[model samples]
Target: MLPSPLAAAAPPLPPQSSDEDFFSTASTSTSSDSKPRSPPPTLPQIPIVWPEAGALTASWVADLMQAFEWASKALPPSEFPSVLPVAVFDKLVLTASKILHKEPNCVRIDENSELNSDCRVVVVGDVHGQLHDVLFLLRDAGFPADDRFFVFNGDYVDRGAWGLEVFLLLLAWKVLMPHRVFLLRGNHESKYCTSVYGFEKEVLVKYGDNGKHVYRKCLGCFEGLPLASIIAGQVYTAHGGLFRGTIITPSKRSKKKNRKVVHNPKVDSLILGSFEELAKARRSVLDPPWEGQNLIPGDILWSDPSMTPGLSPNIERGIGLLYGPDCTEEFLKKFNLKLIIRSHEGPDARDKRPDLGGMNVGYTIDHIVESGKLITLFSAPDYPQFQATEERYKNKGAYIVLEPPNFDTPMFHSFEAVTPRPKVNPYYDFEDVIDSDEELDLVSMVTDSGLQQPAV
Candidate 1:
C-alpha cells in the first residue's frame, strides 16, 4: 500500500447548518429560492482501505467510477454525503500534495524518456466538477496507462455538484501513476476563487463538519500543483496561456491635473518569462496577490490569449496579462516550441468570438503565429451545469490527443454533453458567479497603487 501521509479518521457527523452558513455573501444560496430541501441520505458504513500501488489497477478505477455513480445518482446534499471516508480523503489529499510539492512550477514531459517516447498524450482542459462528464471523457479518451499518458490542465473543482469527487478521483490517479499523469493549476484552483465560486460550498456540503479541514487540504493540494507542462519539449500547456517577466517599469508621463499618471507599461519593455523562470516561481502561494513578483504565478493561472497584437494587462479580469499573436510567436520562438495549449474560457468567453466558430467547437486556435499556434481548449460541455434554460450555451466539450514521435500535431475530439445528467440542486446563484475580476476590484488596486496600466 502507498504510505499514508495522514492518519485516517472517521468522518464526524456535521452539525445541522444551512448552506448559507458556508458561502460568502457574493454567492447567492440555492436554498433561499428553492423549496425546502431534505437532508441527504446518510451513506452506510463501508470499510476503507487506502490504495496500494499494486491494487490501483483498472478494477480500482472501476470501483471509484461505481462509487461516483452512486454519489451522482443521489440527491444533492445540504451537507456532505461522506461518500469518501474522512481518513481516506485526508490521506489522499496529503499524499497528492506531497507528490505535487516536489514538482517544479513547470513540468517537462520530454521525448528522451524511453518509456514515454512512444506513448500517446491526451491533454484535457477545464473540468469544472462534472463527474459524469469526466468519466465519459476518460472512457472516450482512453484511460492513462503505460502507453497512454494524460495531462489534465487544471480547474478540477467548482461550479458542479461533484467537484470534490472529481478532484479526489484525479488525485488517486496521480498517486497511482505520477509520471504518466500531470495535473496543472487552473485559475479556479486558488483559495480565493474557490471561496468566491462554489467549491468551498461544495466541500462544506459534502464533508459537513470535516468540510473545513477537507477544503483546507484541498487548498494545500492546489498550492502544490504545478503551474504548467511542456509536452515532448515542443508544446507548452497551462490553464492560462502566457505570462510577463519580472520587469515592470513605471511610464514617464508629464503630470497633468485630472489626467491619471498611468503606469503605462511598454509592450516591448515587457518580457515573456522563460521556462527556467517558470521553474523558479513560488507556486505554493494559495492566492497570488497579483502585484510585483507575485504577478508571475497569477499571470500563469489567470492570463488569456488576446486577438490583439501585443501583451497588456488583462483589465477585465483584474489579474494576469492579455497576450496577443506577437507575444505567442515571441514565447514560442524563444523556447523553440511549436504550440501553446491552454484552457480557462468556457461558452461565455467562446461565444464572444463569433469568428472562431463560437461555442460550436470545443477547441479554438486563437492565434497562429509563424512559430506555431495558440490553442484554447475547453472540456466542460454545456458548462456551468446548473443554469437557467435561456442562458445555456449548449456547448460541446473536447480534449486533444497527440501521437508519439513528434507530439506536435494535435487531434481534437469534441463531444456533446452526456444525456440526462442526474438532477442536482444548484449550489451557487447563477447570477452571482461573474467571470470578471471586478468582483475583487483589482483594477482599482492598480490605480490605488499609482501604476497606470501599460498600453498594449
Candidate 2:
C-alpha cells in the first residue's frame, strides 16, 4: 500500500478547463503506392489553457503522465516527435522558470504554519529520466498537496531515454502546485552536462528540427532552479552536499636572508558561509565553471561530505568541496539544523567510493555527527538505465518522508525499478559517456554539434 501522510490541509481545487478536447493527435500519411508510413510521435499535452484561464485538472496531469509512458514505450529511435506550435511546451517552461527565478538560492519552508501542521514533506533524489519509475514513485509516495510538499533534488534529465517526459511532468506539477513542489538544480541541469550527457541528444531526437528551441527553453528553466532548500528550519537539502565557507587566504611572499631566498605562504582562515550569503549568492548562471568567489553555486550543486575533518576541494569531481564531518557539524550547529539530505551518487560512484555504502538499498547515512546526520539519497533505481550485462548496478530507488511538528527524523521508502520499462536505444554514443571526475572538451562537443560555443 502507498504510504499516506498526516491529513492534508489541501486548498480548494481550482475549476477545471471547460474544453473537452485534449489530445493533440499525430496524422499518418500515405505514399503514392498506398502503403501508410508510420505516424510520427507527438509530445503529451492537456487542454491548452492560460494560467489565468484556470489551473490544469489533476486528471489532466494524470493523463499527461500516461501519455508520456505510452509514447516512450511505443516510439522508435529513428522517429522524432513533432513539437511544432512549440508554444505549448514554451508556455509551461517559461511560466515555471519565472516562478523559480524569483525563489532564493536557498528556499526556506518553515514549519508550524497553519498549512504545515499535520502535513509531510517528501524529499526525492536524482531522477535521471526514467519516466515509468517516476510514475511508480509518485503513486507510491502520494502526489504533492498543500500539506504534503515535495522537494525534488535535481538531476531530472539525462541518462534515461525519457528525460524530456520526466522533466516536463515535473514542470507541469511545479506550475500547477508551485508551493508544494520545489525543484532544486542538480549539476546535470547545466548546459555543459546536458551537452555531454544524453539530454541534449534526447531532445534533438524527440523533437526533430524544433529540438533546439525546446532545449534552449530547458536551459532557461535550469538557470532558474534553486540551489538548495531548508525544511522547517531543521533539514538542509541540496542536490550535492555541503557548500564551502567564505575564506581569506594570504598570498605567497618571498624573503631573502643571508643570501638565501625563502618563500612562505600564509595559512588560510575559514568562515562557514551563512544562510544570508546563500540567499545573496547568484545562481542563475546557465553553466558555472566553478571559478573564483562565484563558486558558491557550484559548491552548492556539486560538493560532497567526507569522513575527514574540515573542508577541502572535491578533487574527485574537479569542482566543489569534500567537506568532512567537522564541516557538517559546524554547518548544522551554526544554522540550527538537524540533518543534511543530498543526492548525486549512484551505483557507479558507489563502487568507486564504498565508504558511503553500496547504495544497493538506495539511501545511505554517510555521516552521523553529534549535531545531526548527513544522508545521501539516490531515487533512480537501476541507475544509468541502459547498461551492458557487465555494468548493471541492480540498485533500488528511494525517497524520504519528513513528518512535521518536529520534522527531524526521516522515514525512508525504497522501491525497485519498474519492470519491463520501455525498450529504447540510448540517444548518445556510449563512448561519449565519461567518469564523473573527467571533464568534457566542451568546445569540441559544441563544434561537433555544429553549434557555436556557449558564453562562459
Candidate 3:
C-alpha cells in the first residue's frame, strides 16, 4: 500500500493545459520543402498564481524569471521558445508544504519543520523521453499535489525522440516548485549522448543554428545537479550505484591532483575544483585505456547495467562495474543505508529485479538517474521501442512507492510489471537473410501466425 504523508499544509492548484497539446503546433512544423520560416517569438512571462505562503522567494523567483526571459531573448523567433505552458507553472506552488534557505550545496527538505516521521517517498525510474509513460506512471503512483516526497533517478534524455519535451517539462516543474522536485545528472546528460542521439538533432531542428545554445543550457543545468541523495538518512539513492572502492577520505593533494581521484566521498572536496576540472576528469574516465578489470568509480557514472555476478574475469577490461546482490547488501551495510535506488537500467529489466537484495535494504531503483535527487518523482516511462512485449520486455516499465518503515513493514516497495510490446532485435541482418532458407523461415515464424513446419 502507498504511504500517505501527514496532511499537507498547502492547498492544491487548478488544472492546466497538457504539455502535449501545448507543443503540438510547434512539433508539426517539419516541412523541409517549404520555405525556411522564421522561429516563434520569445515566450511571454507566464503569469502564475502561486499560494501566498508557499510562493517562491523573490530572489529565487526572479532568478527563474530571468532565466525564462534570457532564454526568450537569446533564443531565435523561428525556434519554438515557449515549451512550458503557464498553467503547469501555477500548479507547482500547490504541491509544496514549506521552503527553506540553506547552503546551496545541499538540498534541505522541510528544514523549517521537524522531519516528518511518516514521510512517504516515491522513487521513479529512467524516463528516456517517454513523456506519455511518465504521465501514466505518475497517475498510477498518485501525483499532482500529493503529500508524498519524490525522487527521480536519471537518464532524462537521449534514445527517445521527445527528449526536448521531457527536459522542458521537468525544468518548468523545477522552476515552479524547486522544493518538490529534484534533478540528478545521469551519464547521458552530457555532451556525448546529446551529440549522437535525437537530443542534439531535436534542438537543431527546433532552433536551427542556435541549437548549441539549448545544448549548453542543458549541460549547465546538469552541472549543478547532485550525484546522489540520502532520503531520511536511511535510503541512499543515485542514478548509478556506489563504486566498489568509494570510501570517504581527506586528501592534501593540489586541487588539480585531487580532482583526478576516482571517488572522493567527502562532499567538500568536490567544491575545491572548477566545473572544467570535473568535466575534464569525467571525460577522461569515460573514454578508454584505463587498466582495471572493473570500471573506475568515476566511470561508473556512465556505465551501462551489468547484471552478471562477481568481478569480471578480464582484469584490463572496461566492461563497467557488475554488482550482484551481495555487493548491493555490502554497500548498504557500509553506508548504513537500508536500500539503494538507481535508474541506469530500463523499466523491463527493473521489473525483473525490483528487489535487488531479496531481503529489505533501502536500495530503491528510480529510473531517471540524470535528474536531480530530493523530494520529487518522475512520471516518464519507457520509450516506444522499449515498450516491447517479448520475454525480454516483460519487466520493462514501472516505478516504486516507499512508505516510511514501520515495525512490521519494509522500507521499500517491489517492482510492478508494465505492458510490453513486441521486441525488436538490433543485431538481425535483413539484407543477408534473403539468401538463407533457415533465416527466411525464422523471420516468417516470428512475423507470421500460421506457418506449418515439420517437426525436427
Q: Which is superior by lDDT, 2 or 3? A: 2
Please, what is the TM-score per model? 0.81, 0.81, 0.53
Question: Model 2, which residues run further than 4 Å from truth?
Answer: 1-54, 77-85, 111-115, 248-271, 388-391, 435-456
lDDT of 3: 0.41
**Alpha-carbon deviation at 273 in model 2, angstroms:** 1.4
lDDT of 3 at 34: 18
Candidate 3 residue spans exceeding 4 A from truth? 1-79, 82-115, 144-146, 246-300, 303-319, 347-396, 405-456
Task: Give the whole-model CA lDDT for all candidates, comma-separated.
Answer: 0.72, 0.72, 0.41
lDDT of 3 by residue, 1-456 (tens): 232121132223234343322221221111122122112223334333344675444343433333332243344423343433233332442232112112132233442322365555666656766544443344345442335566667677765545665565555455454555666556566554455445666666555555676566556565555555556656655565544343234466654455444442232222112222322233222222133211332334433333453432212122234454445555555545565566564433334454432111112332212222211122233222333434433232445555545211223322222222112222223233221111123223323433232110
lDDT for model 1:
0.72
Give a tens-digit lDDT track for model 1, residues 282-341. 888766464445567888888888778888877767677888899999999999999899
